[model samples]
Target: MTVDSSIMISFSTASKEYDNQTALRDITFMVEKGEMVFITGPSGSGKTTLLKLIYSAERPDSGHISVAGWDINNLKESTIPLLRRHIGVVFQDFRLLANRNIFDNVAMALRIRGAAEREIKTKVYESLKSVGLRHKSDSYPRNLSGGEQQRVVIARATVAEPNLLLADEPTGNLDADTAEGVMRIFKNINAKGTTIMIATHNKELYRNTGKKVIRLDSGNLVDVGKG
Candidate 1:
């Protein structure tokens, strides 16, 4: 198969199984750089598994997968952290530190990257500001609303400006309006050139948005088109 320079994520005949059940089968798709794509399916249709593969949390049992130009099908365990440096992931559960303030939570990303304290301050503030949460930098996760906590998570994920952002049911715990607010933040980030892929079962999130939708059913690719 021809590799396109603009492709940011590629899955070629990838298959994965756990125990006796298949999570994905012969999956082949590509997400272009700077594009926003959605993966949709039912409760256990492998939506989350697909995102895990891209995040390097799970490896394919067969075929090949690539992200940001790196071949990850056989990616070494020691280099997984290096691969993750170029990718940011948001989960359904807001994994914030209750003991740490919002600022510290976001700073953790830069800290892990060995960024200087001065640089961390500047970038964390910028990221929080981008998500419209700079004012809550001093607040703890429990003190914030559900939507606010999710925004803090977004701030944390994008603090290092990763080239690719992957989200798994990011808005699952929010109301309709709050979910849209989070999505708008994603759109703004993608406008600046980061590739994004969101896995969700909520059709309301992608309806009328005109973004590419890849649907899965029983680990099979069932549909691919504009949402």
Candidate 2:
């Protein structure tokens, strides 16, 4: 297939296996820049594995995967960090450092990239404000409610303005109202031209978002539709 400049993510015959179990099978798809697509299916349908491939946490077993023009399948170990700088991943469980306050947690990404202290402070504050968590910037993760913690994770993921945003069940732990609020934040980020691919089982959230949906089942990609 000819690679399109507009395509930010592409997978060709990609598969992942653990011993005898195959998590993904011959998966192929393209995610264009600035598009929002949902990966939806029952549990264990390879949604998370697909996201992991994009994020370079795992390599495909048999095929090629590319993200933001970087060939993840053949990426050098030293370059993985550089590749991840262009992608933001939000996990089902908010991966916040328990001891760190919200500002420090959100600033960690920039810090790792060697951003100056003044820049980190400004960017971290702006990120927290975007999530409406500016007041809680000094609070530890343990002190925040589940919804609040998730917002902090979101803030951290987007603070650097990544080119691609991968959210795996981002709203899974929230109540309906809180989930809606989080969805709105995702929408706002997408509006700013960031590519968004969300893995979720929440049918209502998918329907309400009105974005293209990519369904998967038992390691097979189903179809794109308005789920």
Candidate 3:
């Protein structure tokens, strides 16, 4: 199939398998630029695997996959970092550095990209302000509440202004109110034109959002439509 610039991600009959089990099977889908999409299912339904594929952490066993018009199936190792610059990932676990304060943690991405210190500081604060956490920049991750820690993760992920964001159960650890607050931050990010895809087994995360939801079951595409 021809690559379309507007399609931020595309899986043309892609499939992935682990030794004894299939994680995804002949899945075909597309996510357009600036859209927020959800991938939901029960436990072990390939939600995480799907996100890994997009992030290039894992590769599909068959068929094709592309992100922002780059053919993932044919991507070179040297080019992976370049592709990743356009994507931000929020892991299920808070992968914060124990020794670093919030400001340092949020500055890590920019530092790795060789951004100037002044530029890093500016972008990092803007990101933290966007997530309502600029006041907590001096605090350590261990001292913050779970919701606050998650907000820090969001700030760090968005500091580089990626074109796309992938979150794996972003609110899995929070109470309902905190989850709603985090969801609000995500919506604001999407409103600013970043394409987002969130993977969750929690139906409450997707229900009533009215965006598109892709459901998977035992490695099969069960449904693809509005949440």
Q: Show where candidate 2 strays beyond 4 Å.
A: none
Error of 3 at 55 (Å): 0.8
- By TM-score, how accurate is candidate 1? 0.97
The full ranking of all candidates by lDDT, starting with the best, is 1, 3, 2
Which ten residues in a row are the worst by lDDT in model 3? 200-209
lDDT of 2 by residue, 88-169 (tens): 8888888899989889999998998899999999999999999999999989999999999989999999999999999999
Poorest lDDT segment (10 consecutive residues) of candidate 1 = 1-10
lDDT of each model, Cα atoms only?
A: 0.92, 0.91, 0.92
Query: Sorted by TM-score, highest first, which candidate order results?
Result: 2, 3, 1
lDDT of 3 by residue, 1-227 (tens): 68988999999899999996899999999999999999988889999999989989888899999998889998899988888888988988979897999999999989988999999999999999988889989999999998998999999888999999999999999999999999999999999999999998878887888999999999888999897
RMSD to native for every prediction? Answer: 1.2, 1.1, 1.0
Candidate 3 wrongly placed segments (more than 4 Å):
none
Model 2 scores what on Cα lDDT?
A: 0.91
TM-score per candidate, in order? 0.97, 0.97, 0.97
Among these predicted structures, which one has the highest lDDT?
1
